[model samples]
Target: MDLASYAELAIELVNSSDPAEDSLRDLDSLQRLLRIRPHLGGRVTRRDLDAMRELRDSLRAVFTAAARGDHADAVDRLNTLLIQHPVQPQLSGHDGQCWHLHLTESGSVPDRYAAGAAMGLAVLISDRGVDRLGVCAAEGCGNVFFDTTVDRSRRHCSPQCAGRSNGIP
Candidate 1:
């Protein structure tokens, strides 16, 4: 399931767009994100940017549902994404590395991102538990995150948010 790899992709995608501001405001921003994660690289377009924004919202809903203790809703939302994206598992050693699982798809950049992110979240929820998905608990920050803490006590999306919430800076 290459959980960390794919799950981080999902988290990055969701975090790129937040209630306060959207990092993916143009084709250039979207391309930059894809450059950061070459697995989802492609010739992006305006349509792709629009689609990615939509995908961000959909993925955020899954985290929101999980945070609310609505497992059924979270599962349902993820299921819809899986059906829409339909990722195919494959093994690839793309950079002269050992063979590892990779979720591949044939479509636009947004489509590929959607497939990988949806499949990753689905596997993560089933293997670790839905509670592993979460929304930032810091006030005014709606970024979503995949909790990796041993105690599952993650409350903010990042250390900066945590510090701000604690009045540490």
Candidate 2:
């Protein structure tokens, strides 16, 4: 799978929760989450859901460390994660069509999530820069997002946050 996709998942997972409530609060939420994230799809169990939540927390720590300009700290945290949930990349294709790279899909939910998310962050840091990761700049909101924009002008996680912060409403 594309490492960029994994990076995207890391950001989305970190931002999934707000002060209002935990978004991954039930199996239905997990199903919805998987529906959007086809790569993270499979027969997820209650244990898998719990593991996914743990992975989300771990990714949050990684993003938080990166956003604070502590690249070394972020790398260290990521190293620990990489150690725990190592990614096994392999080439795969369907019906002898186009071959593509994919990480090992066989593992616990947290293991798979961690492997992909870690590899994605590593790729982002190596190919782009540690500065590519960020937490939202909007006051009172701490959502995380990966900065893929060329000019790196992103600050708020979305335009809604930007509007609220700038008092556009």
Candidate 3:
């Protein structure tokens, strides 16, 4: 399974807005985020947006711990999250596509997202190793990312950040 892709959901949630700078502190931004990640179905509410933000922080911590070479801490945090939001895996398919694994069948918006994120991150660390988790090395950009490069030397979270760090205008 391509758990690495699912694991990147954590990165997406963290990099939604700059943590050390800007933040998506409104319902509209939350809605827009959900639009991009359609797997997190169900109605969203203000409380849910709050919960998601908190969950985002927790997920970020996981990456931070992993990047620091503290895999135990990352695993511990992910374990608690997984227990809190258990994945109810089921096969799903539509639009002439073959069935693929789905995380949760039913839950609140945050629960569904947390469940999938937790499980995906778990699988990711297990299969790929904790070294795959990373934090950007760009100045003023404390973003989280998965190091999927063949040589695993990805220093910045994005090409834009790479250019900025490399003194590109």
Q: Give me the overall lDDT of model 2.
A: 0.81
How accurate locally is residue 148 in candidate 3, as Cα lDDT from 0 to 100? 79
Q: What value does the lDDT take at residue 66 in candidate 1?
A: 90
TM-score, predicted candidate 3 vs. hidden true structure: 0.91
Q: Write the per-residue lDDT of candidate 1 for residues 1-169, one digit (tens) a residue.
A: 3754687778998888764556798888777788977677779888888888889888888889999999899999999999998877788887788888878746778887888888878778778899989899888888888888999999998899999999998
Each model's lDDT? 0.83, 0.81, 0.82
Estimate, for each residue in 90-150, the C-alpha lDDT of model 2 and write its tens digit: 7878667688877756786667777888888888888988888888999889999888899
Each candidate's clash count: 0, 2, 0
Model 3: pairs clashing at backbone N, Cα or C within 3 Å: none
Candidate 3, residues 1-169: lDDT per residue as tens digits?
3455677677778887675444458877777777877777568888998899899989989989988999899889989999998888888885677888877778898888888788888887888788888999999888888887889898889899999999996
Query: Which wins on lDDT, candidate 1 or candidate 3?
Result: 1
Rank order (by lDDT, best first): 1, 3, 2
**Model 3, C-alpha of 63: deviation from truth (Å):** 0.8
Whole-model lDDT, model 3? 0.82
